[model samples]
Target: MGGRFGSPLFGASIKGFLNDRSALEGITSFGSFGIGITGLYEYHLYLPGVPGLRPFLGGGAHVATGRASAYNPYADSQFSDIYAGLDGVTGVEYVFEDIPLALSIDVLPVLNFPGRIGLWWNAGVSVRYVFK
Candidate 1:
């Protein structure tokens, strides 16, 4: 589990490797206003000299439902909103040797529409416990 806080978002995520260089992630996030779910496919590049360090780029989509506190000008706080968006992520992850832990720093840019077109970006740091 990790905190991907663009706007104080707390969520849990599961990551699985598809091959040596590709991975997938499912993320569920919640805030005071609502909840969001996202899926991403990433391609990782390992550095030649840096062990356990990889940088990745990915894109996916998200579906969210909730009320807007102030983030969306179109949605009122009293009502709930259901929207979908496209997401792009780029980050670096480091896995510790002899420890089942990974640390990541990433940025996500999202575009949401149907209600309105909203484009924004967020950066966050996360610590993940890896289960083997």
Candidate 2:
């Protein structure tokens, strides 16, 4: 009865910081900011006989939004717009037996219209709790 569990789990995280498209495009004339949230289902992918460490993978969709602004001295005004998009994520995680914690890194590639396709990555420490 210890192979893989069939249930749903919930978790949350805060990102340290993010790199904006303006920097990637080499456009210093504009300023931008971005943040994201995600929900996913976990599926075990390791051998059941293993005891110390376990590895798993997850897939989900996330919605992110950002704002960009550009200044124009000739027009005597600043141009700004807010944009949002949805992205897909897939990554692996590792859980240690000695502690009730897990660590993972995921690559989230998004398709944004009126903009360019870019990849956003997130890596952080996480804690896992079992509920029955």
Report RMSD (Å) for each prediction in the order shown.
Answer: 1.8, 13.6
Give all candidates' CA lDDT scores: 0.80, 0.35
Best by TM-score: 1
For model 2, how does the per-residue alpha-carbon lDDT over 1-132 read when each residue is reduced to its tens digit?
011111111235422211211100000111134333454434445556765343444444544444432211111113333333444444454556666555554444444433444444333334433211
Q: 1-132 in candidate 1: lDDT tens per residue?
A: 544545546687778888989989888888777888989998999999999999999999988887876655434456898888899999999989899988888888988866877786756676778876
The C-alpha local distance difference test score for the whole of candidate 2 amounts to: 0.35
Question: What lDDT does candidate 2 reach at residue 12?
Answer: 51
User: Against the correct fold, how does model 2 do in TM-score?
Assistant: 0.44
What is the number of residue pairs that collide in model 2? 0
Off by over 4 Å in 2: 1-32, 69-86, 113-132
Off by over 4 Å in 1: 1-6, 73-77
TM-scores of all models? 0.89, 0.44
- Backbone clash total, candidate 1: 0
